[model samples]
Target: MATIGTHSGAFQADEALGVWLLRQLPQYESAPLIRSRDMEKLKPLTIVIDVAGTYDHDLLRYDHHQRGFFETFDGENKAAKDGGRPDVTGPETATGEFKTKLSASGLVYKHYGREVLIRLHPSLSANPDALDWVYRKMYEDFMEAIDGNDNGIELAEAVRYKESSTLPHRVHRLNARWNAPKDGPTEDERFETASALCGAEFGEMLRYIVECELPAREIVETALRARTAVHASGRARSKRYELERRHGLPAEGLVQFVLYPDSSGMWRVQAVTVEGTAFTNRLGLLEPWRGLRDAELVARSGIDGCKFVHATGFIGGNATYDGALAMALKTIEGGSTSVELK
Candidate 1:
């Protein structure tokens, strides 16, 4: 029965995302949305975002165009006359004070984004810590760019070249061009297109954080906690046997290189891809063994059971667990000199 009001005419990513976020809530799932600037029509609306001349949270009015309006997530500078101290302690303020501006999308996200995420994935609600972490991480990774752009916060002191491929720029291009034909799509149609564009991007980002990045973090934390069990130096680890089926995640989720006993009764060391996706390793084997094999590798490294190191320095293997552990430890210790085994 409630109505959501935003500005009419060309829409920006801020208002588009703001409206989309509101629709995700149960109360507003099917609520009618009115785009108008007339106060008379907006007065009866349940919530107004990005257009009203006021920003009263009690009344559900979210706008940032007013003068002397700087609000952050943690209320660190919400009351300061000049945006408060730059050293405020908070995830949003960890970088600096200039990042405190909250646009309409930011306002909605700060207030209700976590609930929205949980609604999308009910499993996240079970883990309060994961939910909290993803909430902050989403702000840092995705929403901050939208907020900064909408608030006109300069990211750099100066720019030597212009950039046209940013998400905002691409969304803006969805509008009717200056040279568009008179029979071109109407302003409302253009707005719908832009809204869909922004909505799809927002959904994709949420899915990635929820399904991919968050799970990888847990795997990494588990491996880091149990690192000492794999090697005395705590520098080598092999989750190939321990965490293989536990989370349905590959061993590469945590370590740079893994040491495991091969099927031929020989121990092997192999590089773990970064983040389980990148080609680069978290840490590479020593340079001396790189591109060498068999006798050459064994002679240069002076370690028994020495195998070949990849030419790209991403991986290596040895014939024994101790040899693999030695290689992993030497690489972790900067690989400047040979490691003396006990």
Candidate 2:
């Protein structure tokens, strides 16, 4: 049976998650684990992660502790060994080279994520675009934080506040408290628990993405394709959008607002945020029109049937489809009176 190796002492989320990610592959699914720092013992294992001070993909040894280990998921694919040669993908991180360096979990994820995702949801195999999107999405939505935190990279140049609600905190707490009797479960045993924790969380995220987010993507895509038919911007429409609390598609920089019907049967003219950002918008609705409702909003924006615009301007609602679209188009065209519903 193949054997996996890692340091035997304390464990971090990177190695815990790395161990779990490797097992997602068929070859390593049931492979035995050896937790030790002894090179003599590690030499014969099928893989070693987060230890041994080496980061060679060909050898199946992934460690980020070595000197000169500068790797990142910079969204540019490059050759691993040479680092300078650009390629579609190296055996290493799927992203050519990114601004953020990856940890053991990230390294494993970058290489084998697409495969794991396919296994988790077979339907993704048929849609290459979605597979690619999800691979990056998983990193942005989940793995990047693990990679950054494991690498000791600060969220900001200066820490503004203590953040303990993140996944890393959970993983860190799983470690047998420092003063506990050694008679408790061994480090190797606790490692299994940690890996399972990371795996379960990751699996839940993958589940939500495939089950909930992807279906919504279809609606957004259909709405996007027919945007020019509705308005030149295609961003402000009445049938498909509610991305304010969710993610919008990676539409480059074209979309500005997305008007979709809300659950209340009202049409929403939601502002499209800058891709990859939380709330910064590409363009927001007119300022004077915000915080107004009903007659005031209709009178202020000069668009009939306007209901209300959120004070933040991230979203607004209209009683009718035409009203919402008109609000969307007016924002895109800079409040020009000539811009009217076609």
Candidate 3:
């Protein structure tokens, strides 16, 4: 959670202004810029500039290697063909361009052996002011995370074994060491601390991977539809199998949510299914989500598809088209004791 700007070398608030000004250079202002096929050959220099501050300088000063961002591509820079020389090479510096076809393109930064790609929203169109806003905003959020970060317990520890040190055991031991109530009251307090810690940790990790890492803006709509289908299936065995067949869902995983009482008695909301592809297909089978009274279910599944689609990064409205026959699951449970007594 340590912020990029907190480090001694973090760009000053006004540092980005110089880079911003350089970005404003007209395509026709200079000779055509150079191009490099070897992405590793190009080095990225990051300047954290606060445009509102007292900073003013050329956004890009000449590197001895003769490199700058391409404003217009006539491909006329002298170093483009000569395999541009290294501008600054040593233990502290390495070279690369921070370019990604999916998003913004810029210089790649290597600091303390870690490589981070600097990018922006494409709609921002590489505008200096927009970049300024993004840098400051990111810095602010980073600072906030450092301030209010939560450390939670996980549920997976319940089953995880230990070889002197396993996941749940390790987690449980850590909890007892750090969070056991000093009052030393009842045995229940010990259980509560252990349980809560594990559950919270697992939930936090789950939420991070599911919510933030997944859910790309592009496929949000498609995922919503897929999720609706899964929600409509209920617990019907055939529906579950059919969904699996159609969506290539996994056989195992769980979804958890609190139950709420309604006009129909207590109802369980579809929080988020832990199963990946299997969950999608399960939902996929429940299509035409009309008359679904549970808005939470509807909303959850509607949003579920977006999560799946984003995670997989696959395109095609044909999520439903990829169907196959479901194999029946055989079970051997008999009638209840009440039935036998009757």
Candidate 4:
């Protein structure tokens, strides 16, 4: 594992930054402008750093304090809550000999074979830029230090956090946000989702996609042909199908298909789903057909253009499904049919 080890001074120094800065002392001008005594009260600065190829290691430090009025080692231990130092580092002293508030700390990066340690100070965290710079510097310095000297021990693949093993919640939150839904895809929303699912699958799961796509397409085509035959035979009067598919199809929940006829005699089936999950069964139905209609239904949604129809107080003049599809297909296929959404 890649880990770091350091003395207690580093940790205390990190916490002292806020306390010293909030205090009325005039010694440190670069300290953060922290007004609250609570470390949690500090407004966290939003920062994004790129750690493309490298992972972090473990950090270890001694939690003891040095004798003085008060001093912060790192931005982490300004007003330490753990009153006195333990037997881990040095011998105990009088209660007031040193300010029990802040303590020392350090991080250890277990590079190739040896451990590279980086000392931390409190002032670094108080400022966002400083904190980032310190972390990057430490990473570089640790890598360089390990390259210079190795003790024959081989490094492992894991990055262990020896001290406070908790990773920042902010990182997880950012990742979730990155994977959240935005808007519908212009071509087919289902395709986008399928693509994402396929990309996330691993090992054998990835292989299942190749075996499924062909059969799925056949199902979709069959469903489309059935719908067309019904239209031609006049069994179904409505040419417009709902954009959502129901659970009749096994993969109905996986993909959505819409079928709409243009002015042309040919019916177009639009398979809209994520990339790899675009499989259809013999019914020309997509797998993701959960109560939602497939993209194939869109072709049956009357005409592409919007238009308004005025009522002349006539009896029984409602449009039938067969006429609608025929009119739509004609208009779309460059025939003399005209329809509008407005």
Better structure of 1 and 4 per TM-score = 1
Native-to-model Cα distance after best TM-score fit, residue 45 in candidate 1, in Å? 1.9
lDDT of 4 at 280: 24
Best by TM-score: 2
lDDT of each: 0.74, 0.77, 0.25, 0.26
The C-alpha local distance difference test score for the whole of candidate 4 amounts to 0.26
C-alpha lDDT (0 to 100) for residue 306 of candidate 4: 21
Error of 3 at 239 (Å): 21
Better of 3 and 4 by TM-score: 3
Across 161-263, the per-residue lDDT of candidate 2 in tens digits comes to: 7999787888888889979797998777888999999999899999888888878778776666666788764555423233322344344326677777889
User: Better model by lDDT, 3 or 4?
Assistant: 4
Q: TM-score for model 2?
A: 0.82
lDDT of 4 by residue, 1-342 (tens): 111122111112122211221122222223332222232332131110011111122321222223321321122222322454332222133233321222221211212111111122334335554344334343332222222212111233464444232121111222223345676332223322322332232112212322343234446445644653644432222211221132232232222224445464434333332331223211222222212222322333333322211121000111344433443333223322111111
Q: Which regions of candidate 2 are displaced past 4 Å?
A: 74-97, 158-160, 179-184, 235-253, 335-342
Q: Return the lDDT, model 2, position 8.
A: 86
lDDT of 1 by residue, 217-300 (tens): 777567756876875554466433224445454433344467767677767777655442345565667877789988899898
Error of 4 at 1 (Å): 13
lDDT-sorted candidate list, best first: 2, 1, 4, 3
Q: Candidate 3: minimum summed lDDT over ten consecutive residues — where?
A: 323-332
Score every model by TM-score.
0.69, 0.82, 0.18, 0.16
